[model samples]
Target: MRDVNPKEWLALGEDLAPKLKDFDIINPHNFPSYIWAYYVKLRLGERSSAIIWYCHEPLRILYREITDPKGFRFYSKYNNPELKTIDMKAVSQIDHIVCNSRFTANNVEKIFNRAASVCHPGINMVETQDCDRKNFRMVTRIYREKNVERIINAMVLIRETRPDIYENCSFEIVGEGADEGRLKTLVKDIGISNIKFCGFIPDKELPAFYAGAKAIVYIPLDEPFGLVPLEAMFHKTPVIASNQGGIPEKVINGVTGILIDPVVIEVLTDAMQRIYDNPQLANELGTAGRTRVLERFTVDSFINKLEKKFFSLSGVK
Candidate 1:
């Protein structure tokens, strides 16, 4: 696919205007789609309602990377006034706005000075046969923002402080990214041999991994909407995630799973040990997590909200 520039996005919008003229609800999923809706509105006026489904505000990630005190390296690349202007225009022109999580809704309020309805993405539950759920696993791309290294460091702490718990427990990292080599080097440096990097696992095989895992750990920086925790919960696996971002919105502390300050190695280590030493507690958390998913995060519930929103916006009976 060709990389679309802002000028191209505007041109594409003009092209799509006539095609989308008759649609009652022209919902845009991204910036380009926002442009399409904008042009459609310009062409069709009140004949079509333009709603923007923000899968997190388009520039929230860039903003976070720029404002990161540790490093503002990404900021230099995205410091374009024209891009921000277009983004603001797209946000302003939308008839209604919706977001994937409350965290994202708050960002929209801060960035666009607009309130948004939160319609979280759904989790598809999968069936799996019995297997030994005796290991802790994290399913995520190995990226700096993911804080995957924090989990690895916490595991090393577990080995030093609670060798007994460490002896019986295993930690696995699944998925691959640029940080894979660095993470492997860190593990080797720490002399922890039990940690295994499973690389990328296919979606079909993921259910089995989740089914047999003791728990999941996911703690990404300013995560817009974390699906790994919910996916794990759907498989009846407990989760231990960072207290920040959209994680707290789903994984209720002491109920579905444990939430800790991702940077606190001792706290994470304690959580790890708690789950390892008490299988009953783990099972309780896992069962509760599964209940949470069934009630709140299923695909049916998500689609129901979207359908309701579309009907409400279009004045459909």
Candidate 2:
């Protein structure tokens, strides 16, 4: 893999275009890679290889109104309009587009006026021995769009209103990002003692955290497709996620886990307390979640769908 800087991708794409012709398929995973792929496809006109873009989400800055209208205005305001034009051009030249969820596919279609196939990514099913459930966990990057602060606010409400539940419960934040300092400051300023910032945990060690958690709290604002809840479910841990975005598709409200409008602190606090007060309900949700993952979101299922898409695009079958 070439370690080319993203800022220099356009120039390097000119140099690397000829070499990419050797591959049967050119699959670019992100926007910068899509730009490079566009360069290669342009240089090697009438090429045998097909370019497939695995879009996590369309250029988020272009769809700020839908993704995060209230927040992230700074990024949307300062972003160059040329990037949107270039991304649209690159998307038009691609042979096929696959999105991680239907929500994302719809956004791509709206942006590019092009249809994209939905292919949900899968995860390894993790098995863990039962242990006493402790803290509620959140394993996500502490970004502005993630809505981590919503949960913090909910915790404060829980502390004030439901002291009994709050006394027995603690929240474990298990990831780091650009907003980490601000979030830590928020926690400190509020004087919440139960919330712990455990920094970044290795992938292999994540299961232990999941196993020990009563339930995973994943309430991101307009998440295109979230994997943290799936990972938590795989460890037989219940999930409390937002009702918005592709999360509702993965988590069945009141079945696999509880879903709420995370913007409302009272609703979020109620869900947390419900999960904490009732261990039987938590266990039931956890079991159903694992079953859902096994039946629908396994690695084998994901690979089968992806393999068919690859063969059809490459004319291998």
Candidate 3:
């Protein structure tokens, strides 16, 4: 699937458009779907509300590549100026827009000059079994943007500065990506015994990992809207995330979880110790995080808000 080109995906979607009929909504998820939905509405002469999910537009990817060179290196061939123009046109014709986070909403408004309603995607509450929550776990794709190296450096700092807490605590990295080999080599060279790379855990098996974690350290660089933070919250696990991107929207500093600047290793080390030294603080944050997820980030809540937005746009009610 990774071998297939974006144009091929768009072509396949357009080919299948004629078969679909009588839908109340022409909602599109990725870039291919946007092109597909536009053509489908035109072919069927459909009056259905065309609401774009507005997740990953290629222009944004291009911008990210330009702005953050050290962050992620995207192939130059994928940066198509022609597709950007087409994407802007397709977005302009849509009846309404829904963004996953305020970070994404800001981008949509800036590019399209249109306001977007933010409807955060939902995560299910996982039932936790009786297991000892000891180590700090990070469940993210091992990439430069994920800042797995920063977390490891912070652990090294802990071992040097605060050896007491460092001796007792452990760190676990889950999920697989391009940076996995480099990250494993880093832990080995640093001689960090506590940190281990646990390769990709299936979705069904994720509940146990989340439930058993003492705290989830998710400090990704400019994450649009991460589900890991919400999923961790649902499992009643406190998180220590970076104070950037959509993460701030999910975690409240000193309330739900600790937030730190990713560059500051000392601050991150302190946050880890604070949670380790004080179980009361951990419990408070964990309980609050779970409550926040239940009230705001539930699937039912997302669906209800989406229905309202769609109905309002179409004037059905």
TM-score of each: 0.92, 0.92, 0.89
Per-structure clash totals for the candidates = 0, 0, 0
Q: Model 3: what TM-score?
A: 0.89
**Which sequence of candidate numbers ranks them by lDDT, best first?**
2, 1, 3
Which one wins by lDDT: 2 or 3?
2
For each candidate, the alpha-carbon lDDT, in order, equals: 0.79, 0.84, 0.77
Any runs in candidate 2 off by more than 4 Å, and if so which?
A: 1-10, 70-76
* Tens digit per residue, CA lDDT, model 3, 170-266: 8988999988999899899989888889998888989889888889999877777888988988888889998977789888998899999977788
- Kindly provide the TM-score of model 2 when superposed on the true structure, using C-alpha atoms: 0.92
- Tell me the tens digit of each residue's lDDT in model 2 across 83-136: 667777888989889999999998888878898998899988767677778888
Task: Please report the candidate that would top lDDT against the real structure.
Answer: 2
- Please give the RMSD to the true structure for each candidate, in Å: 2.4, 2.8, 2.8
